[model samples]
Target: MQAEPCDQEEPPSVLWGLDPIFSAHARLYVRDILQMKESCQVPGIYFYRFHPIFTVDVLGTVVYRRERDDFFCYGVDDGTGVINCLCWKDEQWKQQNEHVKSAPRSLASSHGGFNPVEQLKKLQQAQRSRSQLEIGDVLRVRGPVQTSVQGQREIMASTYYKVEDPVMAVQISWMLELPQLYRKFYDRCFQMQESDLTDSAQSAPALLGRASGLLKDFLREKAVERFRPYDLLQKLVPLIPDIPPEPSTQQEPTPQSSSKQLHQLLRETLQLLQDEGLVFRKVISQDPVYQVTELDKELHRVTRDIIREDSKREKYAEKGCHVLHVLSAVRQRYCPNVSKVVIEVVLKILECNSEIISTTDSHYIVL
Candidate 1:
């Protein structure tokens, strides 16, 4: 198979031109799904409280398989977490699955040289053949993740494609879909790795683990709502007790045991806490700050009310929303007892961490 080239000299700004009715789904790691909790008010909608959009794109390797006369299920792991994926029978997919399973393996392998046209064709072909994937085969699935009858979360895939390299697939997904603040934090960690620490006595993972422990302890002790990574690291590093010499007579601690090992620990710790739903990056600023995941469900209720109000306004042909209207709705529905100043702070935090966008200072749009 050979892919055709586009005749247009310029690329389209939007792959499919701006149509308010159409929006691309978010791509997420399997770990993302595992971290969510069920919505308190909406009985059937699981974890509807976490993200503004419910649909997601998940990438992972198939670890288990189950097929029925009418449906099929596969367990997939993408480093962080594992999710059970269900694909209900669709005739079109069944046909594609059959074709993919029966196709010769030779067509899937690379030829001598890199051919953009050929590579594109192979990818297209791989899409059709995804249903034939074996254990360990990596795949990227797009669909709405819902809790099954058993209360286990599973993706009802609308479509999926074979991934040639799982590592590259995960890296690409994280780079493209992770929040800007989180991405920058990860990049800084990588840059720190490329520093003189590479020549240190401790391995990178070991240093990361130690640093994560120290940062975690500090966050717990301070009980602050949020703090910059650099500032936290500066304070936390001094408190990290120096490692005792094994012989008790050594002149100095090993390089790995030195405070220099704290390089990426703060961010690494934040990432871990985020995964466990204990903490999250309060992405309301350029420098990523840390915040604890609140236990109260008030924020969730306020968010849902705001979204409901936004939807009602959207039906009126309004292009943007006023922040005051949302804040008023929040106060009326969920926080009648809270102060105006407190409500404003909550809205600003939501604007930063949640998907809501600020069109102007007081106007907004939900992503």
Candidate 2:
């Protein structure tokens, strides 16, 4: 009997570098760090879903410690899991340690009414002591992640320091902020354009672009404001080319395969439309219905009016109206189904037309 060949997974595209998050220091839990899948093509790089993470920021208590001549190794736990961190000793601190040892402490104090040099040395020593953490001290580490010889993931510390969090305020803030990051970024899949695919000429992306164009034209011609997936699937089926039977095996494309291809094309096309701000889903449910954004003039009107009215209020007099406040007002007045992303798209259009100005990243004011 012959053995069956296993299907190989495709390597991640180099175009992943174009994504801003791919280069940023991703704040992740120790457990997720340990669980991340390392890229097969690139060593030391790991992926959490579609997001590529090379460097990370972590906060935890030092549960174990080992001292070395040039570096310190620590086991840090942040209520998730423990990971080893290698922190190198600073050369300046090493020189300071030698100077303090060689110089006599009493010699400075004997003449010290107020010696500047002695005070400076004392301050340096205090800082050095703080940097060298004890086993129980809370530590914040930022560095690129790597795998050790024994195949365990570890961080090669670029920057590590002791965090003094009294009354647990820092920890509480971190706990609150991390979930928002996950919700807004980490959990979302990084979308890849059709041009990024391996076969550009006959790839899924080329098909997706064609399908998206067809759907947009259909929406415009029919004046469609709302649509469901099934409503458009029939129109897209003709785009999927029929496969001929193989010469040797005489294998033809199955009905299931054709249906799957049509569905996949529609799915990608819808996602592309959503990204371009042409359409958005009012609700997330088993049966998703899309609203054509361009057809909704009231959405744009309500969003702009809300910003204009709210910007003059005392609450927003300093920074103008915040994006969140605009979202809330638009949802209440215009349409309850309006999303943050749709609101953001509307804001960008209004800004481009010189109807409004961005006071801050999240605040807007009428022109």
Candidate 3:
């Protein structure tokens, strides 16, 4: 007898071994992910800008619901839209959540629920132990973009994290991401000549050379602890003997011969000094002020006293003493004359040199 062909078919094999240049997933809003289109050439994968490696991140709230013994689903809404995410059970996850899954399912009854109070407590406790998350908690998810045969989109999550500040998280996400987008869009939109861009960069360095010496002399005057740009400009212009005189006639003035032009030059010079670590700028009441970075000179003169006081107290062996202790000791013994700003700058330099260590939110430690 002739054999009939079997109707049963094997499951489709996934492309599991496709490696990417960057293992790091891209941070994307839920709207961006949902809007992606499938690549014409690749099956079961989504693409953005025609690139197949479209892994992404989404931060949102998820509502938890138990789907099976080995699975659960979360309906995540990230302001833009909602997505149904499926989290599969790994061996470790299954082991950790065994107690919750092993609970009797007979407790779920049709009429008046059986053991509803007891079941609710067990589920809540299980959720805490398993995901350490509750329904409606804001979370950050990282995963590959997946599109099913029926046009439904989803993310196969690789990592999940609880977000503490959603606003800060969104702001930080755009802060990091917008630069790349700006470059892509602006470069295409305004195609400037390479020579023009290069010339613009070179002009600033030339200005820096002319103004560097004058800036050093102005700072040396010690007229104030810090100077706002306008106040500093008032005192600084006279010191620059080479500053071009204002145009006398109605004739158009050369670029080098205007005080208005010098305004921009002075601003760029201060920025250069800041970049070179020769000065520090801080904003006060919406205005930025510049301070010379010369605390090391004073610190060098009193280094012996600092070490001696630290040794007497055995502070070197423990977490370092606070800046206040060293400041107080230095003033009492050697230099009775010093500013608080000078002392703080010296401590900051020591921290940078690894002579001491300070945590993001804590006191310094001796190293």
Candidates' C-alpha lDDT: 0.54, 0.79, 0.54
Task: Give the range where candidate 2 is weakest over 10 consecutive residues by summed lDDT.
Answer: 3-12
Query: Model 1: per-residue lDDT, tens digit, 1-367?
Result: 7944422211122211221111445555566576655444343333311222356677777898888876678888866578988766556655655666666656645554544445555765665576656788886788876887886888888887666773585656555566563333321221123223323314444355445555555565676656666776565454233633232444754457454545545556556556544555434458666555442345545654575467556452254556566657765776443334444445555665655655554565566
Model 3 lDDT at residue 320: 47
Off by over 4 Å in 1: 1-24, 43-50, 93-128, 166-367
Write out the backbone clash pairs for model 2. Answer: none
Give residue 259's error in model 1 in angstroms.
44
How many residue pairs clash in each candidate at the backbone level?
0, 0, 1
Better of 1 and 3 by TM-score: 1
Cα deviation in Å at residue 139, candidate 1? Answer: 0.9
Q: Each model's TM-score, in the order given?
A: 0.36, 0.54, 0.33
The number of the candidate with the highest TM-score is 2
Q: In candidate 1, where is summed lDDT lowest over 10 consecutive residues?
A: 7-16
Displacement of residue 61 (Cα, Å) in model 3 is 1.6
